[model samples]
Target chain A: MSRLLIVDDDRVGVSALAALLEDDGYQVVALTSSAGGLEALSAGGFDAVITDLEMPGLHGLELVRAIRECSPTLPILIVTGYTNSPAAATAVAYGARRVFPKPVPYEDLLAELGAALPH
Target chain B: MPADDLERVYRWGWLPLIGGCVAVTAAMLAASELLFIHYGFADPTRLQRVLHLVRGAVMSFALALFAGWYMLRLRQRVEAARESLRAQQAAFARRAWKTEQAVGLGALCRLLVHEISDPINGLSLHCRLLERAAGRMEPTDAEPVRRIAAQLRDDTERLQGLAASYVEGNRAPGSSERYQDLSLEEIVRAAVAAHPCPEGVEIVVEAASDLAPVHAEPDRLRQLVEYLLRNAIDPPAGSHRVRVSMTNDGNRVLLAVADDGAGFEDPASVFRPFYPASSLRASLGLAIVRDVAREHGGDTRAANREGGGALLSVRLPMGERTS
Candidate 1:
């Protein structure tokens, strides 16, 4: 079972996504704070990181940058309300593997996570 | 260039006027001296002759001084007028910018809707996932759990409806237009014809002879072309000539309209869809152009040409104008 870290400022959004991902049989640790999300990733066992683009502090792009510096090979997927926005492109540039717009289709996110993971 | 011309004039253009003034003053003095000597008004004494010469010289000096003072005043007035004109232009630009923002309050509403849409959609998705999770719980499907699940489903539907209303209200242009292969040049010609250029406003259209057809809706494309034409030929910035061009680069059909006017304060500003006031209609038109072009599997390019003025163009893939 691949372990994943889900980070978003939306409390319910994070839990809801977490619950579904857990039900799908993946080990998940979800947080509504970027600070905690960073610390969790730094603890060193997660296979992937999913983060929101627009958050109060440490925007998704910065988060991706920080995570990438520590774990160069980890799969990082960015989810954003603002798709096609420059920030989304910047997040990718910062080493995020993919960007999914809000209300992201669950199947697509799963497929992306599966593909981005190490075989 | 205008400033350079003004500076050139200030440098040497006043020489002729000063020369003319000197000639007139000299002629007057000579005539007066001739009259004084010819009329024998002064006694034939050395002192009297000397005094008469001195008086003529004083009067001549005063005349030259007056001419110089008048010319100085004229130059000052011209400078003052030019300064005033510059101030008015600056004030007008500020006011126009404010007006563009005012007319674009519509864009603000659209932005708000977009912002609202994201959260609402996220909420709706969360609910759906929650609903799915709730259904799979074998022994956990108790009465309260079932009620909670039902409530989540209803709330999810409500949130989705709310989001749809906002999206439907603020839908981007040409969202519902039908598409088919159409000659872009034909649409350009019709749009140019529909909007007759004002007198003194010259409009020129250029198209490649073998331009390929683009997959686009004729009516919607016409509307987009008309907006571009109106924005170009009849801009509030004031232009004498506008150029409308259409061509194909093997894969995409490119269409553009350019005007010889004050280009965007920032070339990038032309494509930014939202900015505070000036040329309300022009901003609105360009916004539609951007939205429509994006719908057609392409995008807009707003730029200041190498020569001058702004060029707004949309490039649509010839084979696939829709994504």
Candidate 2:
């Protein structure tokens, strides 16, 4: 099973999304803070990371950069409610594999994640 | 001179001057005729008669000069009036252009907010959660749970409707595009069908039996009606019901939506494009409705309803049927 890290300030949102992914057969580790996500990623083996754009201690782009520096090959996906924010585009430029605006269909996210990392 | 007297003198003094000149010339002619009669005929003192004729000739010249001056004054007055009218038209055009720019900017802001903030995201996520939770329940217990999930889906669609309106508003209205001959009653029905009334809010629709077809962009009209209904039903005002009605005379059609919401906190600023806070979403919605109505040779107005809530009305001229 592919292990994935989910980072978002909204605890309920992160937990809900984690549950959705886990049901689809991936081992999901959910964090409500980006700082914790970085520490967890440093500690070890994760197939991919799904993060939100807006959060405290580190913004989405900064988190993407921090992740990229640590593991250049790790697939990063940004799932944000702010679809129109330039930061989503910036996150993509900084090597995140995909940006999914909130209210995005679960099937679409599933398909994108599958394509990003081999099942 | 008093200001009024000066104005009267300036306007009518030339008329009297011309009239007096004509009278003086006529009097001189009559005096000349008398002089001719007074002069002896046999050895006629023709020189005296000649002198009277000269005086009458001079009076005629003076009368012609005064008449020419009066015509010049009249022409100048007419030119001044024309200039004033042109200035007024220019000012009116400038004001219109400014209003258009303000509206365009407001639309842009509204588009940004609608696109950037997915109000439906949380709701949609909750719907999925409800579905999952329902799946674990007994079949009998799952029925109501599924129904609630369906209602959440309906609310999501309502949010999507708002997003669609933003896109529609961004598109320039074509002289011939997206317009159809639609019944007022049918449009109201469709809008109400899509509306998801909040927990305690009730939505009621009343339409005239014999309603005329309105020639308009279907999306634009839908946006207007849906926005009004959503506004009435969603906001956490004290009211619990919204009443929507349609009525028309032979020449014009009218649609009114009344909400028993907190009645506008500041009724005066309700329809304005931008209000005090980022809560301008409601204001922007109403502004779009008003713009669409005006585009169709109609107008919108708002008022505080008696007892509670607020009333909004949109009036559109009866359009010719293309079908």
Candidate 3:
């Protein structure tokens, strides 16, 4: 199974997403904060990361920037509440593979994730 | 619009007209007198010259008085025109202020809706998960559980659509390229079918034959039709029946929706967005209808029906529209 790291401040949302991903046969590591996410990524063997936009300590873009600097080729995807806002475009510019608006459309997310990592 | 400017015009505007008139009159009199005396038309006597001077002064005063009076009347007319223009300017300013307030509220609602939609989305996604989990189980009531999840998901989607309709209602009407040639009657029929009738309420939709198609934004138009139907079917006092009629009047499409419900206490207040929070839904529905009508180069009106219900009408240009 390919491993995935999902980060979000919304614990319920993160848990629900993690459950869904896990059911799809992915090894999911869920975090409710981005504070120690960088250190976690440094020791990571994850195939991809799925993150939410607004979070305490580090927002979506800042985390994307950090991750890009550390692992340039790691597939990064963002899910945000503000897709119409510049956050989505900016996330793509900062090396996020794509940004999905919440509540995450699971089918699309799954399709994108499937394309990002081999099953 | 300054009172002082009018005051100044009244005080000084006529000085040149009257003064010039008087001067020309006086000069003409003196020249005639000199010419007559030099040509021997009259004797060069002191009494004659004094009489001529007195006559000239009287004529000058008469002419100046007449000219000043006429100018004062003309000035009054100008003042009237200015006052009318000032009233129009004030009215326009008031409308602009209202529009600005609506726009500000729209921006706030847009952000608020996005914030709200996220949670609604989550709730909906949870429903999806519930359905998926039920799929793997062989429980006796599995179908019912799936049905409940499906309803919850559908309701959440409806809530999102309602919020979006309200947010769009608060927006300014301007150019938009997303429009299609659609039948007004067809849209009304679809709305009627989609919107559930309130308990004890029956809805009847009537359309004139051979109704022409209109260029419109179908989604917004459908929302408007649904909102109208919703309002008519459900009121505090309950409604027995509702009737929606559509017709083509020359180059425009006309829609009238009438409901036998608790009639509007204030028909004018129905469309205002800044009502008590309790009436926010009604306000939102009406505002959406109003703005959507305007965006399509149409208008909406509300009135208390003569036989006891409320009557609402919408008229739209049958020509092509950008939005």
Query: Which model is ahead, 1 or 3, in terms of TM-score?
Result: 3
- Model 3, B1-323: lDDT tens per residue? 46677667667878887778878897889797788878996866887778878888888888888887888786887788678878999999899889746644554365456557557766867888899988987887688888899999889878867876775564446524446668888888887786767678888889887676776667667767876887787566267988899888765688899988877888876754533245555556776676556545455788898899989888765644334
**TM values, all candidates:** 0.44, 0.46, 0.54
Model 1 CA lDDT for position B162: 64
lDDT of 1 by residue, B54-102 (tens): 8767866776787678768766766876797799999998998897565
Candidate order by lDDT, decreasing, is: 3, 2, 1
**Per-residue lDDT for A3-47 in model 3, tens only?**
999988777778888888898899999998876566678898989
DockQ of each: 0.11, 0.10, 0.13
Clashing pairs in 3: none
Where does candidate 2 clash, by residue pair? B237-B262
Model 1 TM-score is: 0.44
Assess candidate 3 and give its lDDT: 0.75
Error of 1 at B225 (Å): 1.3
> Once model 2 is optimally superposed onto the true structure by TM-score, how far is the C-alpha of residue B106 displaced, in angstroms?
5.2
True contacts kept of 2: 0.25
Give the CAPRI rating of model 2.
incorrect
Cα displacement (angstroms), candidate 2, residue B90, comes to: 6.4
Q: lDDT per residue, candidate 2, B48-117, as tens digits?
A: 6687678887888978786778767765765666677679899998998797567546554554544334
